[model samples]
Target: MVLGVLGALLVPSLSSPASAAGDATVVVRGTDLPVGGPIELSYVGCARLYERTAEVPQPFVGLGPDQAPAGERSLRYDLAGGTALGSLSYARSMASTTTSGLSVQAPRGAAGVAWVGYQEPADFGTTTYWFGRADVSAPAGAWTSVETTGLTYTWSRYDMATRRAVGGATAAPSTLAAMIAERGDGPGFRTVGFGCDGNRFALDALRVGDATGTTTYDLEGLTTTTVMAARPAPRGTVLTGVLRDGSGEQVVRGTLVLERQVAGGWETVQVVPAEAVDATVTVAPEQTTTYRWRFADRPLAEGSVSEPTTVTVAPGQETSQEPTQQPTRQPAQR
Candidate 1:
């Protein structure tokens, strides 16, 4: 449970409930210089188990950021880590893409997967990023921009600005280009990776670009906003997520939403139960209240607004309402 690039879970993971089989991972280490082309990866696991790992997968050939890179590569699908605080995403080529099940809903259930990885075609070969886990090369931090609306998908954690994509089904953009060649290893060829490469995120396969759009890519509402942390819940305690569609599968009741950060800012109220790939949401914060959790209103993207979750309700419970000073209308001093 001790894994880090910057503080990796120190106990936390309880405020009430919402972490069932919460095995998470998002890897991508380094390398790709002087190779060929085509190798992408993307992280943030479990988005309904990456549409159940491709419903019609199998395809190849597109390498050649020049040559030395190669072609015909495809390991494909895996991603499920939604309930965001950070998930920046990059990649627009082909092969490997996972974010399995995308299950997120913590208020006190705590959280996991606050990822970062970058490799912008530093030559070619090495490229990685994972979901259930696998893929490597590229880790320095800095780069964020997104959009994949329907359920949600918006980000800006890396700070580079631009985040929007919670869900947009229709999928086939090769699972968002294998979720940015695993996780931001840009270029326009094909060689995405994980596993043997030590790409960090411990995923399986996230292959990108599949092409199959008649009209369905509606992953909800996609969004990406940054802040970090959110752990202060009580009440009925439910804040879960897990959706799948556009070729991958698993959608069930599908509707998801929790987006709460109350008072000082951010609020989407609640309307959850996208169907539960492992979902829950019934938080109870009364006093000092402050929240940062996502999958907001459900569609797909819910990337930032954690690191400030501060619910505190007990001893009788039910009193959180104070903070309604919007009056001051005594004009004219004449």
Candidate 2:
């Protein structure tokens, strides 16, 4: 079934985190955190029964806990790990045990993956787990994996911005790099973790890393029409327009380019920062002109031009002529 494939791809047997190319990897070893550390864990729906531990559960080995994959400590989750269905409660109950200081930058052709090792007893039944960037939403049944009575490592590659899977689950490093070159350009920090529907599980050795590649997201139809504030105005009028992305969502950051229809072609007039929903600029054109806005090209989004708008400038007022001379002559005669 597609669900089974997705689960197998999203969740693999425990393995070591992939190494970063040129020191670009960020890792969070479970043993590094203090025991009984304060963490924020939330359960899906209204079910709020869960617990966590940061110690080696030697006694729980019979119940499916395993030694830390890389260090002296491993994070343990018990009580209701596999009780919930993957379709209803996948990662709905999870925690942010530590801060991942991974900074994703836009316009930089970058791609990365998050990996974690977990151990579950054979009796835990079918439980799903996932680790990736925080904002990522794994498809229902994507993270389901049947945990055997031992430790295994699983990893999921993400496009970074959309957090969608890059290639299939358990994608090879080269495949991940190529996928990044094709689509993983949006920027965001990475995260890793394990989750279950009420089965006991232990997780350790979280890691994220990136590589450089020339790839950009296709945002061809993601742009909306440019909305101008005023159509006809004086030569020295301020022209304003709002720039949005492929989904018609206003871009709050980055650069919006203003272009004018010149004698032969379109010429860029100004490159303004997208600081708000709308961007404004003063234009004193010598004649009527056609103008448009576009986003500066970035890794995650391609540069797109908005619909052009023509602004009509009123002609200069005609100078008053002979009336002044006639009035002066009449005054002299009086």
Candidate 3:
């Protein structure tokens, strides 16, 4: 079932089969969306997966000033070279799932992509359902606003185990209640993503709402640091360094990749798991060396690289004390 995002709240009518009793409408306007906050974004590449909690003005490959829709800021995606998918979503925290809706503005010149509605299953698996798709075509450089309701059983049934489409039908919603039903106890709607074949698009004013007071999922920010105790140390001396977050918090999860400056570029030398936040490492160098750390991305934080920390290894020196020869034995023999 699909629900509309109009400002006016509508009561569920008994005349339609899709609309059940005790159904009420809730709306989240585009202007109400948060700015510079955490957003649940997932990007699937042909070869790998990129998922993280990102802030506003997220980076994309082909996005420019003209591509931004008529809004303060938008979620921009640039897809090229292969099939890619990017999505933003929110799931209800309550025991039951609530029907939510979203509105996105896309540029007219965009092609080979469509806005999609999806449902998240209750099972602790990564499977999701694509219930519907909307073609967002507009004039060159113009913006087209497309809105969709939360999806229900009206969409196709997908088999998670086989990763194939089972048997189900896709139809438009006829009743308001059916679209707003919180199928929380069962597999229900959760997130929305774009299905595209190499295209660039912008999304703005994405608002999610339900009958109960549920806030939209916002993206969070992360920080990283790289430090060394001594820059110039004696040859063969072990250089020690520490990694931390912006708030001086230790990051004990994910992988920290250690890299060294090479002739042309940086080369990875070590891949360490972040078992603690105040993680430290020791590196012994034969000559002058430059090092840095690359923090892996987490579900709620974006990955980052630390600034290069150069350590100079000074020449070795002999101690003042010298070894004594067997002078006494030589004198006795003479």
Candidate 4:
């Protein structure tokens, strides 16, 4: 009989899937999005994962400008180890002001919010040029997660050419609920998004709702790659594996299961904790056996498995190698 002493397996996790540049824009209906357009929209840049803040450690988008001079009129989001992308835009019916909120991490002076749509009884005719600077700030070194439907902002009549308020700002800040009620039966939102030229900030878990239901958009997606290797050692065999994200960065934390092939199907050999990026095991197998590593599905990351690894042993070689550590046999679990 032989025992395998395995080290804890360490693998990181992502919040959700990612939407990269050049990919098809994502769209959702019943939310009053633009006709035949994306639910997640960006012009100066695209949306990508950002992990600089503890409050928003998930795959959130960081909005800012590209390589432009200060005060340049740009809408962008900066991606880690990548170029600056554009601001984010979502289609929503301003008419439905049931509830709305978003998680934001911003620095001082970050112009992190906006709303563009229609307004009635305006000096300027109804050309759908209503822009509100919802510049909500966050506490120092913290992220803000607050309901916004009842929040207030002083809207200004927008000018298409200047992309700024045309006339004096409204008398006082008005809540979305009030704005919707005042608009009456006017056309709702043309587009709602985040970005003030030259102001860099981060956002996550954006939520909006109407009479129907609420929808939270978190940019939601990511892909993973895992690999396994087997080599001859003083013991019978040494098995090792690692898991990584799409950018080839090693995953930070998770549990990986060591699986072995049996007559019925693959069976669990042991549970490996990912305290580190790599997982290793020393096994003195009686015969040649095939093994692999598996990561189960998590809240933010998808499930994945490593390529199969095979360890070959000669008849007398299995028990001949000296042991490096005391072998603690772990009972296989289903």
**Candidate with maximal TM-score:** 4
lDDT of 4 by residue, 1-334 (tens): 0111111111121011122322222322112223322233422211211211222111331122222111111112333322122223223334543545555444543333344344454423434345454544445334556454555666766544444456664535686557657665333332223333333555455455445555555433234666787777765677776776665666556566777777987876766665365767666656777888887654334568998987776666536332234434342222
**78-127, model 2: which lDDT tens digit per residue?**
43332211110111111211122111111212122233212122212233
* Stretches > 4 Å off in candidate 2: 1-226, 231-235, 246-249, 314-334
Cα-based lDDT for every prediction: 0.28, 0.33, 0.39, 0.45
Which lDDT value does model 3 have at 8?
Answer: 14
TM-score of 3: 0.36
Error of 4 at 66 (Å): 32
What TM-score quantifies how close candidate 4 is to the native fold? 0.45
Please give the lDDT score at residue 186 for candidate 2. 23
Clashes of 1: 157
In order of appearance, the predictions have TM-scores of 0.18, 0.32, 0.36, 0.45
- lDDT for model 3, please: 0.39
Clashes of each: 157, 18, 11, 22
RMSD of each: 23.1, 21.2, 17.0, 15.3
Ranking by lDDT: 4, 3, 2, 1
Candidate 4 error regions (>4 Å):
1-92, 105-116, 119-128, 140-144, 161-164, 167-172, 187-203, 218-287, 293-303, 314-334
In candidate 2, position 148 carries an lDDT of 15
- The Cα error of candidate 3 at residue 119, in Å, is 8.6
Q: For candidate 1, what is the TM-score? A: 0.18
